[model samples]
Target: MLTALRLLACRRAPRLPDIAPVGHVVGCLSPTLLTSLASGHAWAGRLPSSCRVRVPLGDLQCVVYSVYAPLQPSTLSSTSTGPADFDGRAFLNFGTSAQLGFLTSEPPQQPSVRDHAGIDCFPFFSPDRYVLLAASLNGGNVLAEFRPNSGRLARAANRTAVSVRDCLAAVATKPASASDPDPLISPTLLDERCGGGTQGGSVLGLRMSSCRSLGRLYRSVCLGLINNLLSLCPPAALRQAGIDRIILAGSALRRNAVLRRAAALRFDECQFQSIVLEDGGARQQPAVADGAAGLAAQFLDWVAAGRGES
Candidate 1:
């Protein structure tokens, strides 16, 4: 894993490692495990009620809700020996990379606490992305349409022209109407690889007045995205898992205030405290990468302490 990290950092072709004096080697670990460590919240037998909610937006968007909890006896029905049969290698399969299970370094003699529950292909569905897609569908530049004089004014003001950032700001300030449209926009349009027969997207409730209304469009799209996420990992399931705290991470939640507000409101009823990871009033570095680096440091420390000799 360290070698892979080095290659990625250098952005160079992989080459054979030269023979050198190395004290220890670290194996590849799950990103979820690294993220848990990044939070600096220990969960292996301590603070088992906390949950890590990772919403990472890359080529594909995914939301992972992980907790450290013991495996219930009923969860091991397949083996017939109940929790005793758990082998630490077991994962609660949720189709193509979406899984919920105990993540441990070694199989415990009995059912014990473990880390993750991942849901892949879950769209982040940010307002800017949605507007861009909507513009493409209509064959017009939404930003240009919204700000007809932005180009000329920007030149006078010595600044750049209208952008998606402006659109997101508009959405954030404008209050969502009580009678706002539902499912007016489909988030599946953002990613073509989303499975389960949800390839096509919808744009229902569009009207002459709202056809260009960024706020209304944003609200509708945000609701669709949040609803889809909840269906995959419902609040009820989190409650059942004894999850008390939810750590929200992702560029989508951090940049867009409206999206963050909407997510908090949706999960408000669950009574789980939502924490958005930040550093000195700015977005923090990626948790997984930070965690990986932390592990590498710890490994070096272990070697220095003579623990690696074993």
Candidate 2:
């Protein structure tokens, strides 16, 4: 197994073209895959036992785990001076032996609140302003709710499902239950009477940095799907695909706690594995496994191509 990367850095560089950071960008695993990875010995970790939840970075709708690292300092001396001054660090990548490193300092204590647990300041969105959000990591069942109205998360109704799971096919359980209150944020909320004119809608949802309205469409289905995602998908199924790994911006996930628990559940038949490409990029076995790289590359390519249409 390869050690996870520690990409600690500070400051921004014009030479390093700004990349857009889309929320819930990809489903790095499937529920089944998650289960498989959890069975591996290398899946163990020193994750904070208790995580206080917090609102996600976007939409103010997401629920995530909040970790508090004791003695963790905010500022530290930089070890390298390439373009920015940063004290980078590495941690864990659920169920895998690889380290999850980012371009930031690894303090002795976790932050009381973390907008993003898996990743932060995505190069794509940090300076470039490309925001994306996904709801599931199941390769077959995934959706990318395009940010139609600025940075807010696209409600279940408006979100576009990608290669979603077969179970997600039951998308018509409820028909917009409009009278029930779309409690979650939606396009209609942007209306004047909705109290969202100047407040910036969901302060966190604005992470996308695009105010392009996708217009009203068949969004009721989204509500139904959300129900299914929360209810239908079994725990074992989530285990298979590396459940909860796929994060939706503003999604109310339990953070690293769920990930840690997932590993403790079972992990004998599984093993952590990774392969390095000639380009230096690595592919994990249990989590993203076989074709994740190819799938991701193609997905990004399509996104790049779609820009021409808009």
Candidate 3:
């Protein structure tokens, strides 16, 4: 229920002033639409209970609403209900008007990453729900679909690689980045962007910019991989939190295959049931086929856990 919901209290008169705030009247809206808008704000949590912010207008508090027609993931850190510009009060108090504007308008736009003020997770689902998808050395993409209606999905293997790269670079050079305090680009990610000027630092303008560029490159890679997955995967259960069993059904990894690469990364952490693709399907040596089968079983385990069927 809207706790602060109330009709406009006209100071001059109830005769309906020409410039009355929006909350003077907000009729019913389908909860489905509301849920979509509101639920879109949590990083795996609930939406704000009150859609409208109350703005004071010289003894006449204006019931301001918001209409961020395209509420970017970078924008919603403050409020619209109070004065503008560094009021020392939190942003939302002054942003009641933004809220009012958002609520009264006809379906605002989806929030972008920056709109959430460097916190892209909000106004979106749990970060875990977004799989870290990536293209295989082959043409196929490795991915886990997300179900908005279900549990969290595993982080994309690609994300893991990028993260690992970032971590290693941090340890090696401790460069700044989007996620760092003295945030600068890591030496490695920047080197790739600079076209191999990594050692002399000539290709890169500076360490900071290069680090930022690497973050952007990582995002670009992640997004591109996601697009590929959406195009390649089957329609049903494509958006769920994990891979369908069928993806593994025919995915026995060949030597130096895509599946093997993903599995090789995780081999130290997980055990595999060996099936050597090179040794006439014998377990003479660990092969890509072994990794694929093992990966398949692990993916199945994840799906089962997601469904509480394990």
- True-vs-predicted CA distance for residue 165, candidate 2, Å: 18
Tens digits of per-residue lDDT for model 1, 2-103 = 999997988876467544222222234456675676585554434233332222233211122111112222221111232232232222111111222222
Show the lowest summed lDDT stretch of 10 residues, model 2.
Answer: 60-69
| Model 1, CA-based lDDT | 0.40
**RMSD of each candidate?**
15.6, 23.6, 23.9
RMSD of 2: 23.6
Per-model TM values vs. the true structure: 0.47, 0.16, 0.17
Superpose all Cα atoms of candidate 3 onto the true structure and report the RMSD in Å to 1 decimal: 23.9
Quick one: best lDDT, which candidate? 1
Stretches of candidate 2 above 4 Å error? Answer: 1-79, 82-103, 114-140, 144-310
> Of the pair 2 and 3, which is ahead by TM-score?
3
Model 1 residue 167 lDDT score: 56
Clashing residue pairs for model 1: none
Off by over 4 Å in 3: 1-168, 171-212, 234-310
Backbone clash tally (model 2): 61
- Give lDDT per model, in order: 0.40, 0.25, 0.25
